[model samples]
Target: MTSTMKPSYAIGVDVGATKIAAAWVELSTGQLGPVLRIPTRRDAPGEEIVADIISLALAIELPDNPDSALLLGVGVAVPELVDLHGTIRSQWNFPLPHLLDRLEAALSVPARAESDVRVAALAEARFGAGRDCDNFVYFSLGSGMSYTLCLNGKPYSGSHGFAIHFASSELAVPAQDRSALVAAIPEDYASGLGMVRLWQERGGFPLAQGIHTLEALAAQGNACAQNVIADAAGMGGRLIAQIVNMLDPEKIILGGGLGCSTGTYRTGLETEIRAHIWEQSCTNIPLVMAGLDENAGVIGAALAAAPPG
Candidate 1:
């Protein structure tokens, strides 16, 4: 209220497989109020999840007045494919038949939803690492893996709004002897779950359940843990190199829980990416870590409902 620019607020919700996080965000400056998080009811009924999202949105306290005119609608980042019409086209963690519609009807305000990865890319484009680039690829290495193309400060939602699915690509480690290719899903080796599974398969450590656990073991000088992390990062990097060779984007912005960290994974991925790049000149392309932390998805979700200037 003290600033020259008018203040606008939107409630952003990130509905992940494990947790649902909600926050009140100032759209103009991308500043978030205190965040509220709760475990997601992944196996619960669809209506319960929708109700929980609405409950989280309503809990955000607004300034001046709780029901002020400065408050915009709610935006949600879902863990599934969302079409142009704000409809979740596929079932991922759970089935939500009509999510946005229910939210809007219950809250008596407009609501918009998009794929979580794409929403994160939009947040980066507007307020994070991709802001300076005209075209960038937001490569997310999380519990699962995916990516989004940010073009001119906007995320490119494909025809059906399901374009980014890089994790599904069947790729293989290059064979030195030119033998037959053995293709595997990249996520099974590079993603958080993938890394854990890979660790178990290779008999690294029986107790490593998540990627963070592996990181901790690696820090403690565990050779198997370190090798698993490095190998996964290398595969991730090689895939990124392929992206560079094809799109040649202005920048590659890394996001997600795993990609944003500055650890062995980061070093290994960068080295592998440079080695696999088809063009020598392209190898120098910047790989910027996303500026926002865990808040990126919520901030981005709110941006979807922010009023246009």
Candidate 2:
């Protein structure tokens, strides 16, 4: 579908497999209100999730005056494959394509949706970490993992929109006695869930706990905890550095569970990433923690619907 130009209060919605978050911004004041979250009825079929978000907008009652001659449009972010025209080709966790027409009908405005991580690069580059540089790399390691390269104001979606997920060869390290508990190519080792798993495998817990424990240990400088973190970052950095070397982003921003944390291993990731770079100057290239955390995607979605200069 061709994107029509419109003047409206941009409504940003970051729709994930498990959760849906919406935000409203009054453009003139530049004041962004608090984000609203909706529990994604993942079990429900189709349009239900999308409908929930539109309902959320009406409920939040942003702009206050619905009759204020302001055209209402939405920028939706999904965690899947999206074409330039906002066509979703394939999706893994969340598939709410059934609500496309209904959403536009209910909002009575133009709506655009793209991959969450991809639009996140746009959002952060425009408003957060990437604000200072024209070139940079972003890796958002949520439940799933994604990499986006932003140059100028646009995200480099590559030919298939999954460019930076390049596979890595196992970096040959000297043989050491690792327990069978640790998998070779640790798939469940880098995400939040994985971190919890790592903690459990190390014989360290009652096993059922919240994120604060993860944050607390990393903050406290636990060596075993830090090792698990370093392992993930070491693996992530190798993949990220390859993208960084190719794109030559001024900064490489890390978000999601492990990336957003402050730990000895987190610092070690920067050192490990610098080690892989051919040009050692990348050592100082700045691996930054995500400033806005998870909210970046929602804010970016709002920006997408806002008027462009």
Candidate 3:
């Protein structure tokens, strides 16, 4: 749609490994309207996923009278490395360019796509904790871990559109076998999976309760759970320190399931980060939780699809 004809209502879709969330966003207020979520059919073909996205977008309530409102476009955030041309480059292969094309054709409107975490960063920069900061690092710690650097309100995707792979960073060197160092990636010690693995390794009874159970146990002062969380905090702190030292960002915003922990867990994380921060000047850089929480991806996608002023 032309800039003058651009609608206030746009659709934002956040596609994750397990689920997809789609919402209608009001561009003028940076507010999200109705949100709908469905299980991501990973086993299905790319065409099916594209169809699902378009169907969800169409399900939202919009003014039937074109004079009152319009459907501007759709923006999608996918959990895979996406190039500038909106092509997926990672192993969880999806034909993103083709998907966007299909979405545009099906919806009769423009469509844009971006990396999921990058889109989250965009949301934060525009409407969340990073709103006041010009440069910051956004770390997402959930079932998996990823980060995006936002400079001057734009995500800094590297030359190949893959800048930092936080999960794959080696946090420690294996003293016994140098060759096995690759197995000690930071995510193994810092992510939700890391917490579960650490708990099991400590002889804690394997509960099928997942990260929530572990966090609950830790809150109740379970020694084993506390230890697991501590290790994760230490590792996460080190990672944050490295990012600060390398980028000197104005702020560090944490998001996702594990990153937004409260009470002792949050304290532990902040303490570890403070302990590892290098320069005294860099020590005061704010570490905050994502203001938009789960909505960051969808809100960001909508903003991305909005016509520039």
Model 3 Cα shift for residue 2 (angstroms): 20
lDDT of 1 by residue, 53-162 (tens): 88888788866566443778899998788888777777867887677888888777789988899989988999999888799999877878888998899898888888
- Which digits, one per residue and each the tens of the lDDT, describe model 3 over residues 221-255? 89888888888888888777878888888999998
In model 2, how large is the Cα lDDT of residue 193? 58
Candidate 2 at 288: error in angstroms?
2.6
Better of 1 and 3 by TM-score: 1
In angstroms, the error of model 3 at 73 is 1.5
Best by TM-score: 1
Per-residue lDDT of model 2, residues 124-240, tens digit only: 777778888878888877555677888886788877665535322234344466533433443456555566677778977743443456556766876777677777667766766
TM-scores of the models, in the given order? 0.90, 0.79, 0.86
Note the Cα lDDT for every prediction shown: 0.85, 0.69, 0.81
Given candidate 2, what's the lDDT at residue 197?
77
Which scores higher on lDDT, 1 or 3? 1
* Candidate 3 stretches greater than 4 Å from native: 1-7, 41-51, 63-67, 93-98, 170-183, 201-209, 307-309
